[model samples]
Target: MLRVKVAKEIREKEQLGDELKTLRSKVKELEKSLSGLKDEHARLAENEEKFRTLIENSTDLKYRCDLKGRISYLSKAWEDALGYKSTEMIGSKFSDFQSPESIKFDADEFLKELIDKKISSYEAAYISKSGNIIHLRFNVMLYRSHTGSERGIMGTAYDITGLKCIEDQLKQSQKMEAVGRLAGGIAHDFNNLLTAIIGYSEMLMMNNLLPENAFQSADEINKAAHRAAALTQQLLAYSRKQVSRPRAFNLNKLVNNLDMLLRRVIGENIEFFTVLEIDVGLVIADPGQIEHVIMNLAANARDSMPNGGALTFETRNVNLDEEDCEKYPEVTPGPYVRLTVKDTGHGMDKETARHIMDPIFSIMDPIFSIKEGGRRTGLGLATAYGIVKQNNGQLRVTSEVHQGTAIEIYLPRAEEKIEKKETPQRKLETEGGNETVLVVEDESAVRIMVGTLLKGFGYSVIEAKDGNEALEFCRQNKEMMIHLLITDIIMPDVSGFDLVKRVIKTHPGTKVLYISGYSEEEISNKGTLGKKVPFLKKPFTPTVLARKVRGVLDRD
Candidate 1:
């Protein structure tokens, strides 16, 4: 019995040993799992800290809000940018900081899109604590709680006000450039028509056989034609087409001559003052255009102050070096004539000044819209701008609302004296000798008038409707001596240049005189007309026509 009991006790001890071994294995596995969980928890904590650091320091105004638009949390950037403490902003409604004008009724529509389509971004204006408007681009997403319950909205707000201003300025500039081009083209065509009417009317008035009434009628026609001509000249000046025969002329002389006129134009209310600097040499510019520029600027100043103010015209010589040129791209490193027109009148703000030079702004009269009884068109300044640019000059303006405005016009000085040649006196001779001249013009009335004038001038003038017709005439007259080819530059079918080439080939010694009202730039762009080719801009007086023809004939 003792032996049996010893064996049973040994078996029981073995069972106990097995149970202890199992417990030891279980403890080791639990310890391994516990160590792994600690490592994971440490990594998670590091990642959370990294995320927090990134959000806190970002320039973007990161924030979280509940579905009711109440701010739940905001990054440090939000508080710093908005001048709000974290405690003040945390429970406040996001809409509280928005202006009534800035409230988005579209938010409901956007919310529906957010929930249904997951649309994530929107833009709107926000009002700051200081009442300044701030444009914000909000990149937002719908947030949910861990249990998938709708939590709130989170977003990053980016400031876009500077970018918006740049875009607006770019658009305004593009619009102005487009309008200027259109104005130029219309002016070019109108000037051509004016030339013909004025030229013929002057010829009629010179006739001695006409009765008193006829002479009176002719005089009336002349006056009316002159008025029309002057109008077109202004348009051309604005379009940058008026011939800029720039010469070094004394600015003081120009201003002095117009002193009386300026006073009269501005009226008795505004006092006109001149601060002329002595020995201010001549600026290289078309004097008439300069006069117009002064007039336009003066008019603008006069209109600015209905109650009247002081208008000062100052002149001086400026030497612009390389550094000055860098600041003004339009200015070169050379001598310039500086004319400043300053007025003690209502000034303009930055937004108005930015668009002041635009033709449309001038056309619409937006600048003068706020005045009690202002009479003005924005065209005066725009026209001045066109004139300055055409003269290869620079214009600068400075102004503040209610403080007044100042305009500076800088015209480059002529490097050397431009020699002036007197118009030669015409020698009188009997009309109608046998000189065969080919007349090529596109306009029927102009062609007829020119033919009649040529016949009266004693040339055996042959008429052709266009350049092609003129070429055909030249071909037919190849065997005959064609003394002159007077052709219009712009025409249907063959251009004036093409006709000139064919005529030169057919009649090697044919003298070609090109006529057009188009500007030199326009003609040159069409084809090469060397300086030697005599060109008479259209609407020429009969005397001009006769003289040019005689000059070309004498040269041949």
Candidate 2:
């Protein structure tokens, strides 16, 4: 019995030992779990600090709003963007500062969907303290409590007003460019028809044998044709299709030369004043077109001053910079000639000013006494605007009702010195030469007219309707001396360029004169006529034809 009792006691002690070991193992596990919990708390605190720093220092506007649409938190960027302190905007509803057109999303509707959604992005505009619209793009996310219950909306807003303005300006410029291209296409064909009409009318008026009444009627027809020609030239200038003959000339000198004419045109009732800069920079442009622009602006000013008012013509040199480029986005940073035409007369209202800039808008008042005919096409300012743009310049107008009007024009300054162009010697004799000439043209009327003109000049004229006929004529007349070859630039079967090459091979000594209604830039290889080759634009008067023929024939 004693031995059995001893064995029972030993088993009980073993069981107690096992229980103590289990208790110690549990204590070690508890200590380790406590340590891990403390570390996790420290990590969470550090993450919260980093998030707070990001929100405070970020350039993007950070905000938090309650379900009632009241701002509970606002970033420092509020003051930076909208000129309102964070404290002042903290409790204010976002709708208070938002523009009427800026509410792109419904907050209540978006919040209702947030239980299943996490993130969204949208754009809105806010009215600043300065009364300017501020555009913003916001990236928002739903905020929630640690227990996963919804708290509110938190988002970052990025300022995008500058980008939006630039985008709008670019879109407008592209639209204008598209319209310009369409206008150019129409003008090119229309000008060709005008050239023929003007040429024929001038030829008829040159006849001296007509009766006095007939002469007067022909004179009227000639004058009407010239006006039509002027209209076409204006269209070509606006479309940038007209061939530019750019030369450096002083703006002050140009203004001086037009002073007498301007005074006469503006009338004695209007007082004219000049405030030209003494040493204004030179501008490179077609002198004729520049004069046209000046006259148009002056005429506009005269129209404004119906009764009697002062018209001031001013000029100065300017250096445009980055800020100027922003205002005139199409202009580059460089030196420019600044011209201002100011009139103290009946000024235009904002609406009238805006409409007048369009080429189609014209004011019709028969009793205005503005123009000689008292009928304005309303294209004067439009033409001036177009010419400036074609020359890589800028035109800006400002006006206020009963205050006055000012028109400012800026043209890029030319770097090169002005060089005198050589003029052809005058042929005092009103007679023709005895030189043999060949004319090739596709148009029957043009061909006949040219042949008659040359024959009347006492030249032995050879005519060909097409290139094939011209080439055959050359084959048959290989022995004949053809002193000059006047051909159209473009023709059927063979181009003028090809005809010239073939004719030159046979008649190596023959001079060539290329005539075309198309711009030299359009048909030439590098926007230049061939070296040593004479060129005459179509719609030439008899006098111009005689001078060009003599000039080419006399050249060594």
Candidate 3:
């Protein structure tokens, strides 16, 4: 019995040892599992903090919305972007922040599509706290629940207002460029026709043998033709195709010269003020074009203030540095002369101001003006805009509704001293010269008229119908002392430039004078005129022709 008890005790001890070892192994496994759970929790906490930092620090507007389109969470960027705090926007519907025209797609429909498509992007305009519209491009993704059902949307919005403005400006510029090309072509043809009409009319007026009544009729025709010529010049100006005869001149002086004329145009009701800067720098630009700019602006100001108001013209010298270049991208960093025109009349709103430079968008487009007995072509401002730009200058306008309008033009300063031009009171001599001259023109009327005029002016005249005839004449009369050659720039058989080149070889001492109805740009190159050759514009009176011929012939 003693042996049995001892054996039983040993067996129980062995079983207890096995059970204890098993429990110890299980405890070790549990410890390893606990350690892994703690590490995983710590990793998840770190990931959450990183995501929060990214959302909070992002420049773009980040937001979360429920499937119902209600805002649940919004980043602090909402305050910076729309002037609305996150707290103020948390419970608001997304549509509440959008303009009526900007809600292109329904919120519910957008969410449905987002859920069905998994992700989407689009553009919309949001209304800011100040009531200004903000353009935004959105990038969004639909968030899903654990059960694979749609939970909400996570999205970011980027501001695109500046880019939108630039795009609008580019589109408008392209439209104007197309119109300019068309206008230039039409003006070239019209100018040729006007030259013949005006020249012949003047000839009739000069003929003393004509009836007394004929003088008045011819004068009327000439006056009307002059007005038409002015219109053509305006077209050329707007198209940027006008040949600029740039010279150094004082802008303040130009303004001062126009003082009497500007006052008369503005009428008795309006008050005029001039603010000229002492020692204002001279600007390099076409004097005629600059005068037109001032006149156009003055006329516009007059129309704006029909009920009577103050019109101010001011000038000053300014130096634009790199900072100015950034502020005014159309201007360079250099010395500039600024001319400002300000009026205390009705001002334009943003929408109207945007299209102020468009030729057809005038207040006169409706066949009437907002004021009594007012009519305008709306091309005045546009011509000024083109002239300023072509001269490497900048024109800027600002206006507010019922407040007033202001226009600023900045032109580059010139290095040379300026000499103001004045018309001489002495009458130009119209006496005929005895020098032998050759006239070439494609138009029969123009050719005959010019030949008759020169003959009347006492010059022995020879006429040619075209370039071929002119070239043949020059070759045949190689020994003839052709004192001067006056020819039209464009001809059928040969260009005037080529004809001149060949003729000069035979008659080396013959002085050449080019006549043209074409704009300087049209006849500048492409086998047209030589750089140093003297030119006479068509539609000129007999007096102008005689003086030009004498001037060229007398040149040493």
Candidate 1 residues 453-498, lDDT tens each? 7788788888899877777767776798888888888887789998
Give the Å error, residue 13, model 3.
Answer: 11
> How does candidate 3 fare on TM-score?
0.82
Query: Can you give the lDDT of residue 285 in candidate 3?
Result: 93
Better of 1 and 3 by TM-score: 3
Q: What residue runs in model 3 are displaced by over 4 Å at the alpha carbon?
A: 1-54, 63-73, 84-103, 106-121, 124-127, 140-155, 275-280, 316-330, 367-374, 415-428, 443-445, 460-465, 472-481, 491-493, 506-508, 527-531
Candidate 2 lDDT for residue 259: 94
Give model 2's TM-score versus the native structure.
0.73
Off by over 4 Å in 1: 1-105, 114-162, 240-261, 274-288, 314-340, 346-361, 364-378, 391-404, 408-434
For residues 362-437, write the lDDT of model 3, one tens digit per residue: 4344521334465554476778887887788888889988999999999999987756565565555666679999
Ranking by TM-score: 3, 2, 1
- Highest-TM-score candidate: 3
lDDT per residue (tens digit) for residues 278-315 in model 2: 87878977878889888888887877777889999999
For candidate 2, the 10 contiguous residues with the lowest summed lDDT are: 361-370
The most accurate candidate by lDDT is: 3
Each model's number of backbone clashes? 3, 0, 1
